[model samples]
Target: MKFLASFLILTMLTITNSITAQNQNTATKTITVTVVNATSDTGKIGFALYTKDNFMRKPIQGKEGKIKNGKSTVVFENVPSGEYAITCYHDKNNNDRMDFSKNRMPLEDYGASNNVMAFAPPTFENAKFLLKDKNLELDIKF
Candidate 1:
């Protein structure tokens, strides 16, 4: 009787652990970012995903995609439910960085997650979006 009870308890524990692990796996979701108005398909589009703590300083994730029909798309996978912002720039010269003029103005086209166009730099509050139970898609124009 003791052996049978121990086996049943172990089996229940294993099943419960497996269910918890599966739930955790399903909690993470994907985010799709699309740059809608790239000037040309000359070079790759660079995308950066930022959390509030590291907004505009260092991106937690980064991706690059080629432009097609004046649009570029990137997918960020396995993003847990939280607030995130995105910034993307058209690397028109294929230099892997946004170009800047001598006066410190950006030469390359750039955009934020909320399509914010401002004289000053974008902030986390202005560009942040919540990633909850479902996947998200954003269209930003530059």
Candidate 2:
């Protein structure tokens, strides 16, 4: 009967759509950023993910992680494959923000991708890393 055939087709389509959605979810990548030498484990670590176009201005994703054993790790899950940079700092004062001294020097410890910290502020080019289909682990030293 036409009714039976239509019902079967609809059920098959529903199953197919579900499988496609699950595949899409698994396709996105994950990045694990580990920050080392956090001054202390009292406050949390603030991290930011940046792209070339939005470097230092706006972070596409920002998060906070608890420090343990003098280190903190942040995981960015379900990320699309692209080039991105990372910046993180140990919020020693529990102020939920980075503190700067009168001379513009960082009051707390900070780290960037590739452990890059040169004369100038961290540039996107200096800290950029490739995120592919597979997972990534980056170790940064402050």
Candidate 3:
């Protein structure tokens, strides 16, 4: 029956399209971030990936790596491909947070994406990056 044949072909095409879309949505992407100018041991350094809204998406582990005299790396595993911003600080005092001066100035050096920085507070847009299955290197100065 031609009707049955046409129906079967349409169903197969629909299923194929669905499978393609699912694969695209579920593919995992690896993003490697190499930090420079860090002064603390790798584990002591704090690194976090954030969404454009500034909410913490994930925290990077130092066990996977450690910052040398002034360098470190974090490989975000299986991250869904998307836009993200990186912020890292050396917790020299192990306070688990960046210490700021009484004037709200960052006592310890900090780095953001694209190194977007200013005398005033930096915005998330300054550090945005498009991740698409490739390694991105960023430099931070402390």
Span of ten consecutive residues with least summed lDDT in model 2: 21-30
TM-score of each: 0.84, 0.79, 0.73
TM-score of 3: 0.73
Candidate number achieving the greatest TM-score relative to the actual structure: 1
Model 3, C-alpha of 9: deviation from truth (Å): 5.7
True-structure RMSD for candidate 3: 3.6
The model with the greatest lDDT is 1
lDDT of 3 by residue, 79-116 (tens): 77778777777777776777898988888767766776
How big is the positional error of residue 118 in model 3, measured in Å on the Cα after superposition?
A: 1.6
Model 3 alpha-carbon miss at residue 46, Å: 0.8
Q: Write the per-residue lDDT of candidate 2 for residues 59-96, one digit (tens) a residue.
A: 98898999999989999887887899999889988898
lDDT of 3 at 66: 66
Off by over 4 Å in 3: 1-10, 40-43, 55-65, 133-142
Clashing pairs in 1: none
State the lDDT of candidate 1 residue by residue for 116-135, as single tens digits. Answer: 78987788888999998899
Which regions of candidate 1 fall more than 4 Å away from where they truly are? 1-26
Candidate lDDT scores, in order, read: 0.92, 0.88, 0.69
